[model samples]
Target chain A: MTTAVLFDNVSRHFGVVRAVDRVNLDIAEGEFFAMLGPSGSGKTTCLRLMAGFEQPTGGHIEIFGETAEGVPPYRRSVNTVFQDYALFPHLSTLDNVAYGLMVKGAGREERRKAAEDALAMVKLPGYGTRRPGQLSGGQRQRVALARALVNKPKVLLLDEPLGALDLKLREQMQEELKSLQKSLGITFVFVTHDQGEALSMADRIAVFNEGRIQQLGRPEEVYNQPKTRFVADFVGSSNVLSTKLCQRLGVKAAFASLRPEAIALAAPSNGALSLAGTIAGQSFLGATNRVVVDVDGARIAVASPAAHAVPAIGSPVTISFAARDLHPMEDA
Target chain B: MRSEKSNRAPLSLKIAAAAGLAFMHLPILLIFLYAFTTEEKSYQFPPPGLTTQWFGVAWDRPDVWAALALSVKVASIATATALVLGTLCAAAISQTRFFGRETISLLVILPIALPGIITGIALRSAFSMADIPFSFWTIVLGHATFCIVVVYNNAVARFRRISGSLIEASMDLGADGFQTFRYVILPNIGTALLAGGMLAFALSFDEVIVTTFTAGQQSTLPIWMLEELIRPRQRPVTNVVAMIVVVVTFLPILGAYYLTRDGDQIAGASK
Candidate 1:
């Protein structure tokens, strides 16, 4: 399959700050890919570069194998669902969605019919005549989606498109967007800071930090085997095993990262790395209980099944995990 | 339950508001009342009789017609110049960042903030130094200097209020530069520019100080009114023309007020 979007050594610098350091990436055609990072991590900047809103300060970018250097955003064959759903306040839903077709000089009736179909795809049928002001937050989001999809571009870039919605609505939209992408078979490059959203939806995820991609892989690989300490800490809650603990466990790596769920509260078993520590505290998290164990001046968290009996704060417990669970992380 | 104190203001505040309104509007009310007075020469507390003859007399005077036409022409040209220049300046300042950006904004607004006489004196000196002849265009040029400020203020505020993402989204949706502006930027700033134009027109119509310096022999309506007041001919007719000026200028000011007030509450910009 042809590459949908490629960034070759792309970098964007604003004054002294490097927003996107030299980065190379390739997204497959018709794949749902995510650029996941915290604020100022350059995920959104990379998206903007692909959309032709901002040219790379150095290096190059390509869309469908075409060099995108100096291309104006209007000439690019991509659509964006902005974080704030920047719909035209003056135009009705129909007119706003038809804006792309209208600009291309399509006849009124033809554009209107397509806009209506697009709205229906977003489950906002019969919302054509209403202005954006009349719509609720979720409805306005749908309108923005319809507007972008009406144009039928090869790639759709979503910049935290669900950022404004309430939690429940956001989750609902996430599912809707995933199914929509699947049905359309179009490439989607979603930029977001929410790890759960990225993990749940993206076919592959690029975890970014400090203007560079720390790790890029399938969600499970990034989660299970973070290549950098930053990726380990960012992708999820990770316990960085102290050097003393690493020595005690017979691991020779500089630093090891183990997920909270990887360790469990149980009697020492054969074929597992075992450590004796005092149970410092326990917090109930519905299905699982997170227990912080203090061992040799380091606090290690162990995820225990909530069905297990709770140990007293001062009780000594042995935590065991398979030796393979300890994933060595790159030294800083 | 809703508190009564929150629903109704204190009595003193209500009285103060009423006094403030009267203070600002009572003079305009006096202008309206004097326009109908039958007395011709001396001021009277109350008009001895009311007559509509002054309106007909003011309408027939050739000089009055000339002044009115000149005022309309100058205001039209000034507003046109302001719309083009001010909107362009607003777009530039709001969209781009560079060295001295703030200074340029301050300079553009300085004419409006300074005393009108100061602007008038500066314009006169500049015109004299350049050896440019004072004519209809000169009056238009003088009025545009301040009119542009009004339009710039409105346009810049609206432009800043607009989300930058909207422009990017428009362009990302395969719209060319002109198409993005037509669909996204224009609708957002249209009302603000309209309000600014109306206000600029009203300001130019009643402008007197700058016209005094730049108009040379041309008598705009306000200048003619000044002359009629000094010479004291058909004083009631002057009052009638004053009424016309008040009505003409008042409508646009009212229109501008409503237009800008609605602008603050944009149609779909709740968040």
Candidate 2:
């Protein structure tokens, strides 16, 4: 497989603050790659660098193995679906999609045909004459997709494309986007702050923090085996046990991550490590109950099925987990 | 009962509002009233008679036609100049960051913010120092100073409202800078530019104080109206021209109001 986008020690500094630090990454062609981080964590900045909207203060970038640092956005073979949709309000939906073709000097009739086909691909057929303002939030997103996909860029950069939608629509669009990317056979580099979105959509996830990638791996590896404290805490909220806490739990690793769902409150298992802790609080999560327990002054959370009875607050309980579920990570 | 009470203003407040409006507009309406009056020379609350004869007389006067022609020409040229210069200044101020950007924006709008007499005096002194003749072009140059401010204000507000992503999205879709401007920026700011141009045209059409200083010998419509008021030739004819001027200026102002009222609907504006 060829490398679609390569970031070789890319660094973008805004005065004293390094927005994107010396970050190295290789995104394989036709892969659904996600750069996931919180606000100001530089995930968005990295996407901007890829889109050619921002230049790195120091580094080299390649798109499809061609040098891409100084090339303006119009010259690059990449298109972006901006978070705000960015459909032209003045133009009809058809015209907004056809804008790229029109600017490239395509014949009017030919561009119209292509724009219509692109709209149809996004399941927005016969929406040509309608303006963006007339469409719903979901429809506007489809139009934005059609506008970008019409160009058939070598790499498509999606900047939180479904960030504006409600939960139901966001999930529906997430599935649609995954299938669409597969059918198109195009590499997608998606940037989002929501880890669930990154986990569900991306083939490979790069967890970013403080302007650097903390971990780069598949969703399962990143979730099941986080390499750093930041990744463990940030992705799926794994409990990062310090060296002292690990000792209390009979774990030899200096630092380890234990998932909330992996811990169970039960009448102690014979072969599992068990700890006595009082239930400090419990929150209702729809499918599960999150119980925060204080065990030897270390606050650990356990997710139990909501159908299961939750012990009253201040009630002592034993939380147990097997050795296989405890994963080790670096302190940082 | 509560809904009805909330919907209607008190009678005293309604009368006060009506009084304020009449105080401002009644005199202008009287000008429209007297334009068709038969009284030839003097003010009368209720006219001695009514006739359409003064409009014909105003139409026949060569000086009236000359002043009207000069006024139209100056306003058109001034509005056109303001549209170009004002749009360029607005684009620079709103689109990019540089040293003294806010200061430059303030200076561009300073001409209109100052009193008309101060601007007029400054222009006259500058023209004299430069040895430039006071003519039609001088009057246009004077009008353009304030006209550019009107265009700049409207264009800048709309420019700030336009999302920068629209421009970036345009470029990412294979549009060069010029193409991005044509496809994205221009269309988003189109209504604002039109409204700004209309307001500039209206302001320049009936301008008087600055024209008084710059027009050494030339008399625009407003200057001619002032001359006619002081040295009365036919009072009703002056009123006829005044009535026509009010209508001419009011139409564009009304058009501008309606055009920008729905401006919040512009895409990229909300975000």
Candidate 3:
């Protein structure tokens, strides 16, 4: 496969702080990729780097087959849907979408038709006369999407595009974005801090921590097999098994990740590994109840279905899981 | 708890409010009243008589017309000069960062902060030192020093309120520098520039002390009115000119107020 964007040991420093430090990454053409991390993890900085908004202090960047460094954003074959929506408040929706074409010296009539078509593509047909201030939050996001998409950039950069929307709208837009990417076959680079968004949308995920990529793989691989302790904790709140705890359980001494859902609170009949502990606390998640068991001094969480019975707090309990379910992880 | 009684103004406050209004407006009402008085000479309140003849005399006077023409021309050119220079200074200061940016901004706004007489004296000396003859252009030059400050104050406030992302978005959509400014920046700050230009024009139209220094032989409308007051010709005629000057300046200030009235309602960056 061809590389769409490449970062070769890219580094960006602001004073003494390294916002993006020595990062190496590649995205395939037409791939749906995600950069996921918490705030100050350099995820947003990386996105800005790709958009040509920030210059790296070291290393090189390439977009498609062309060198990207020192290239102004207007010259690059990429467009961004900004986090703030950034629609020109003074212009009508049609003019805002047509702005790209107008700047390119297209005929007025042709640009108007193209802008209208783009608006319709984002399911906002006939919204040409309304100002951005007149539209609702979700509608404004769709307009922002249309304004970027109208340019037909080779790559689309989305910086938390759904962040401002309410929950139902965010979920709806996620599904819509996935289908849009599929139909258009354009490379989409999405940056976000929400694990669920990254998991539900991106074909491949890169989990960032302190300006470094802790793990990079498909969603299934990243979730089922986290390479580092940070990835397991960040991706899905998996219980980290300390090397000391592994030795106590009569297993090889190594750091391992155990998902709470994988651990069942029931007596094992087929010689499966089991840990004895007291039920320290219980939280009622909508679909599953999370029970935190105090095994020795380590707090191990177990998620059981809502229909299952939960023991009272402070009661003794046994949590069971197969030997194959405990995946080893690095101490990082 | 707030009550209907609390919402109503106290009687004492109502009397004070009326007194303040009378203090401010009664003089202007006096000017309007005398503009129509039939008497050509000095003070007669509860005017001895009233007639429309002074309006005719004020209209026919050639000196009055010359001064009016000069005032309009100077104010127009000064305002245009301010719009260009003040807006550029504001953009340079607000949109980018460099050494001494704040110091430079302070200097641009200093002309209006100083007392008008100080500014007038400074300009007179500077022009005489340069050996530039006192003329219409000299008066315009003096007027621009302060007119530019008015525009800069308004333009800078509006520029700071605008989001930087709008410019970035324009570039991301393939707009060049000039195109980005035209399509994005200009539209967002358009009303502010218009408002600033109007205020600058109004200020220059009725300016007195600065014009006195720069206008060597000629008289502008306000300078002419000053001369008319000291060495009296027709006191009522001066009042007629005063009424016209008030209307000319009031229209623009009123327009500016309406244009920028909904400042808090300006759309914000998406939350």
Highest-lDDT candidate? 2
Any runs in candidate 1 off by more than 4 Å, and if so which?
B1-41, B44-50, B268-271
Clashing pairs in 2: none
What DockQ does each listed candidate score?
Answer: 0.62, 0.49, 0.50
Q: Candidate 2's residue-wise lDDT over B1-271, tens digit each?
A: 9999999999999999999999999998888898988877787769999999998899899999999999999999999999999999999999999999999999999998899999999999999999999999999999999999999999999999777888898999999988888878888788898899999999999999999999979899999999898875689999999988988999999999988876656644332
- State in Å the error of residue B59, model 3: 3.7
* Models sorted by lDDT, best on top: 2, 3, 1
Q: What DockQ results for candidate 1? A: 0.62
Q: What is the lDDT for A148 in model 1?
A: 91
Scored by TM-score, the top model is 1
Docking class of 2: medium
Name the better of 1 and 2 by lDDT.
2
Ten contiguous residues with the weakest lDDT in model 1 chain A: A236-245
Rank by DockQ (best first): 1, 3, 2
Q: Candidate 2, which segments miss by more than 4 Å at Cα?
A: A247-253, A264-289, A304-324, B2-18, B37-41, B44-53, B262-271
lDDT of 1 by residue, A1-332 (tens): 99999999999999899999999999999999999999999999999898888888999899999999898887788899999898888788999999889988999899999999999999999999998988999999999999999999899999999889999999999999999999999999999999999999999999989899999999999989988888888888788886777887899988899999989888767898888989999899999999999987689888889999878998998888999999988884
